[model samples]
Structure formats: structure tokens, C-alpha cells
Target: MKVKVQSLDGGKPGKDIELSDEVFGVEPRADILHRVVTWQLEKRRGTARGARERSDVARTGKKFGRQKGGGTARHGDRRAPIFVGGGKAHGPRVRDFNPSLNKKVRMLGLRMALSSKARDGNLVVVDSLDVKEAKTKALKERLGTLGLGRTALVIDGDALSVGFALASSNLREINLMPAVGANVYDILNHDTLVLTRAAVEKLEARFNG
Candidate 1:
């Protein structure tokens, strides 16, 4: 796909960039996308979740009462799951939720995400962005020039310019990341995908390499 490169002022860059078909033209797989997204979210969980099980609860192993009670139902240990403040049965425990997915699936998921963005006209290309100092105002102005107000993801080919990263650090709606760090969540979360010409080339190479 051929897309016009825009300047920071939203004006045409006097040049256009041709995106690769392999990277931005793949058919989206909803199932893979869903699985990948779920995997990503699961991997972020902390190992703090815990629950007391029957074995963990303190209770005498001896019979609390005769196997057959006189009037009431047979009684067991105080830590039985039925009793209040007793240990939980088959409750959630601290463990990993990560699912194993093939590397090819992951790559396809990313490509599909990019393709979806491209098809929806949510992707934008720019020649380059230069920021001498790390200032949020400067980044905000740049985004305004592009007429991107809602959540935006800025992708740079190499290491993010120190100034640009600093400027975007405080903005919750704007995210700046290097090409290597790009992920499905960031791409889908933003209302628009802003890519520099070099960034686009680098992304294609990484995916098609």
C-alpha cells in the first residue's frame, strides 16, 4: 500500500512510502489474535494470589464426633470446607497462567493486527520526528499537527529519540516505542498507529526476515 508521508505540521512530506504487502496485507485471524491477547494478559499476572486448602488449615485429624452423630449430621474436622472460616476446596492457587503458543502464531498475530490497522485507515506514516529536548509540550504539539488527539502509538525504527521519549512519558494517551518493542496490545490500544518511514521498513524486515 502506498501512503503519503506527513510532516510534523500535518503537511505532505513531498514524498510517499510504499508499505510491504506481506506485513500489512495479511488476512487477520481472530482466533489467533484472541489467544495472543489472552496470553499477553495472563503473562502479566503477579504470583500473589493464594488460598488456604484443607491441608493448609489447622485441624485435628481425630474425629470431632462419632462417625454417626446422635441427632445432627456426622461431624468431621473444624476445617471442613462447609464450615465458616474453613479452608476452601478446589480454590484458586498461585500458579502460572501462561499458555504455550508457537512462535509462528505470535508473528502472524502481529501481522494480522497491523493489517487490521492498515485496512481501517488507522495507520499513519511520517518521514521523521526530531525533538532536541524532552518536553511534553513539544510532543503534544507534534501530535496536534498530525490531528491525532485520541490514544496514539508512535513507532520509531531505532532507539527512540531521548527527547521524544521524555516528551511522551507523561502522556497517558500517547505511547512511544521502538520498533523492536512493538507489541499487539500497544498497537490495538491506540486509536492510530503512527510510524516513521524507517520504522515501517524495520518492522517489515523484522517480520519477514
Candidate 2:
């Protein structure tokens, strides 16, 4: 598929670039996308949450009442789960949330995400992403003039320009990443995708290999 490359400062059409159909023109698979997104999010989740068990509680373990017949039932100790100050019976424990999926599935999910953006007309191609000065305001103005959405993801080549990286760092709504960091979740999270010609070439090579 061929997409017109445009200027970063102003949305002027430049030369067209060829994109691989397998990479950016495939039909999006919702199941694969969901699995990949879930995996990504789960891997980043903190596993520090824990609940104290009976043995971990500081309450007394002495017998509260007779083990025989007593009004309402026999009591064990203050650390019992029936008591208010007792530890939890089966609460959540610290454990990793990382999910493992097939490598082929992950790659396919990324392709689906890119293809979905292209099919929805939410993908924008640029000649290159660079800034004269690393000023946040200047970059914002330039992107605004280009008619980008409030939340957009910009993917650069293997090496991103220092000025462009620093300029976009302060913008909360804009996400900048190199082709290596491109993934299904980040691509689908943004409202629009801005790709440079070099980034597209890199992505094509990556998927092809």
C-alpha cells in the first residue's frame, strides 16, 4: 500500500511511500489485539499487594473458649478468621501478573494494530520528525499546524532525533517512541498515529525479518 508523506510543520503532501500489506494492510484481529494488550498491561502490573494470613497476624493464639458445646459454637483463638481482628482466610497474595503468549501471536497483534489505524484513516506519514529548537511550545505549535489529534503517537527510526525527543518529553498527550518500542498496546492507545518515512522503512524490515 502507498501512503503520501507530508511535512511535519505543515500538512503538505510529499512523495508517496510503499507500505507492506502484511504489516499495515492486514485485517485486524480483535482477539489477538486484546490478548497482546492484556499481556502488555499485565507485565507492567505491580505484584506488591499482599494480605496477612493467620500466622502473620499479631493477635493472641490462646484458646478463647472451650472446644466443646458453648453458646453460638466453640471458639479457637483471637487469630481465627471468624474474629474481626484476625488475619484473612484466603486473600490475595503477592504474585507476578505477567502473561505469556506465543511470539508469533504478539507479532501478528502488532501488525493488526497498525493495519487497523491505517484502515481507519488515523495514520499519518511524515517526511521526517525533527525540530529546529528543542522547545516544547515550538513543537506543539508545529504539530498543531499539522492538524494532529490531541493524543497522537509518533514513531521514529532506529535513532530518534535528540531535539525531537526532548521537545516531546513535556507533552502529556503526545507519545514518542522509536520503531523498536512500537507495540500493539501503545499503537491502539492513541487516537492517531504519526509515522516517519524512515520509521516505516524500519518497521517493514523488522516485520519482514
Candidate 3:
């Protein structure tokens, strides 16, 4: 499909770029998109939470009460779970929360996400993205003129320019990522998608390579 390329400053229409049908024309599958998003969020989880168990408590192992004379249940050590300051019986342990998905499925999910954006007219292509300096206000105003939405993702090919990255740093709603960082989760999370000419080429190579 052919999409009109626009300038970054005023969003004036320039030339048209042809998008690969395979990458930008696939049929969107909600199930695949869901799985990919879930996997991404799961992998970002920090499994650092820890709980002290019975063996980790620093307490004496001496018996608490007489075996038969005590009216309550027989007690072993002060560190038992039944005690107030005792360790937890069954508690959460530090572990990985990352979920795994097939590489092909992940790729498919990305394509589907891109296709969905294209179908919904939320995808746009820009000639380039260059900032004279790392001025966030200027960049924000430029992006606003383009009607790129308050929350949007700007993707560029290869390495992201330092000036562009810094200019967008203060924009909490706008996220800038390299083409390699493109994923189903970010594509679907944002309200609009802005891709540079180089970014579109990189995306085509990625899926068609």
C-alpha cells in the first residue's frame, strides 16, 4: 500500500512510499497480539520479592510447651508458623516472571499489529526526524502540529539520533524507539504510529529478510 510521506516540522505531504503487503497488510489476529503483549509485560516484571520461611527465622528450636499437658496444640519451636513473629509457611519466592513465546509467533504478532494500525489509518510515514537542538518544547510543538496525538510512538531505523531522543525525553506521552525495538505491545499501546522513511525500510527488511 502507498502511504503519503510528510515532513516532520509541518507535516506537509511530500512523496509517497510503498509499504510491503506482507508486513503491513496481514490479517490481524487478536489472540496472537494478546499473547505477544502478555509475554512482553511478563518479561519486564522484576521478580525480586522475597519472603522469609520457617528455616530463615532466627529463633530457638526449643519446645514451646509440654507435649500432653498443654490444652493448645503441641508446639515445636518459637519460629513455627503458628507463632506471631514466626516465618511464613507458604510464601512467595524470588523467581523469574518471564514468559516464553515462539519467535515466529512474535514476528507474526508484530506484523498483525502493524497491519491493524494501517487498516485503522493510525499509521503514518515521515520523511525524516531531525531536531536542531535537544529542545523538548520545540519538538513537542512540531509533533503537535502533525496531529500525532498526545500519546504516540515514533520509530526510526538503525540508530536513533541523540538529538531526537533527548528532545523527546521530557514528553511523557510520546515514546521514541528504534526500529529494532518495535514490538506488538508498544504498537498497540500507543494511539498513533509515526514511522520514518528509514524505519519503514528497516521493518520491511526485518520481516522479509
Candidate 4:
């Protein structure tokens, strides 16, 4: 598909970019997208959550009462789950939430996400641009020119552009990421996917490989 290239000033560059059908025009697979999103979210968990079990609780091991009821419910130690301030019963534990998906499936999901964006007219291609100095104001102005508010993801294929990255870091609605660092969530969460022409090519190459 052909898309018009725009400049930072939002002016048409009098040129257009040809997007790869294999990457941006594929049929979106919702199932694959769901799996990829789930995996990405799971991998982000810290797995540090823990709850005290009966053994971990500080309490005397002596039986609080006889096993048979004596005009009251039979009771165990103070650490029993039924008691207040006692150890949690079947509570959450520290464990991995990561879900393993095949490498091919991951790639497919990424492609589907990209295609979904393209189909929805949320993807835009721009001529390669760089920021000589880290300036959030300049970045904001540039985005303003393009009429993009809300969440925006900027993808660049060149070596790390620290200035550009830093400029967009403070903008809550803007996220700067290299082509190699692009992920499923980053692509789907943003309202706009701004890609430098080179970044689009790099992404296609990476996924189509």
C-alpha cells in the first residue's frame, strides 16, 4: 500500500512510501493478538507477591482446643486460616506468570497488530528526522503540527537517538522506541504509530525474516 510521507511540519513531502503487504496488509488474527498481549503483560509481572502460610505464621504449635467440639467449634492453633490475623489460605504465592508462545506465533501477532493499525488509519509514515538536542518542547510542537495528541509511538531504525528519546520521554502521550525494541503492546496501546520510512523497512525485514 502507498502512503503519503509527511514532514515534521505536517506538509506533504510530495513523495509516498510503499508499504509491504506482507507486513502491513495481512489479515489480522485476533487470537494471535490476544495471546501476544497476554504474554507481554504476564512477562511484565514482578512475581514478588507472597502471603504467609500456616507454617510461616508466628504462633504456638500447641492445640488451642481438643479435636472434638466442646459447646464450640473445634479449634487448632492460633495460626489457623479461620482465625483473624492468621495465615492466608490458598492465597497468592510468588510464581512465574510468563506464558510461553512459539516464536512464529509472536511474529504473527506483531504483524497482525501492525496490520490492524494500518487498516484503521492510525499508522503514518514520515521522512527520517532527528533531534540535535534533547528538547521536549520541539517534539511537542512537531507532534502538534501533525495534529497528533493522545498516545503516539515513534519508531526509528537508526542507532539510538538519545536526543529524540529524551525529548519524548516526558510527554505522557508520546513514546519513542527503536524499531528493534517495538513490541505488541506498544503498537496497540498508542493511538498513532509514527514510523520513519527506514524504521518501517527495518520492521518488515525483522518480522519477514
Best by lDDT: 3
Write down the TM-score of every candidate.
0.76, 0.78, 0.82, 0.75
- All predictions: root-mean-square deviation over Cα? 3.9, 3.9, 3.1, 4.1
Using lDDT as the measure, what is the rank order of every candidate, best first?
A: 3, 2, 4, 1
Candidate 3 lDDT by residue in tens digits, 96-169 = 78677999999999999999999999998998887666799988878887777658999999988788888888
lDDT of 4 by residue, 59-149 (tens): 8878877777567787768888988878899887889777789998999889888899899898988886565557888778887877564
lDDT of 4: 0.84
lDDT (0 to 1) per candidate? 0.82, 0.89, 0.89, 0.84
lDDT of 3 at 50: 84
TM-score, candidate number 2: 0.78
lDDT of 2 by residue, 98-194 (tens): 7899999999999999999999988999998866788999899888866677699999999998898898899999999999999999999999999
Residue 72, model 4: lDDT of 71
Which has the better lDDT: candidate 2, or candidate 3?
3
| Candidate 2 global CA lDDT score | 0.89
Candidate number with the higher lDDT (1 or 3): 3
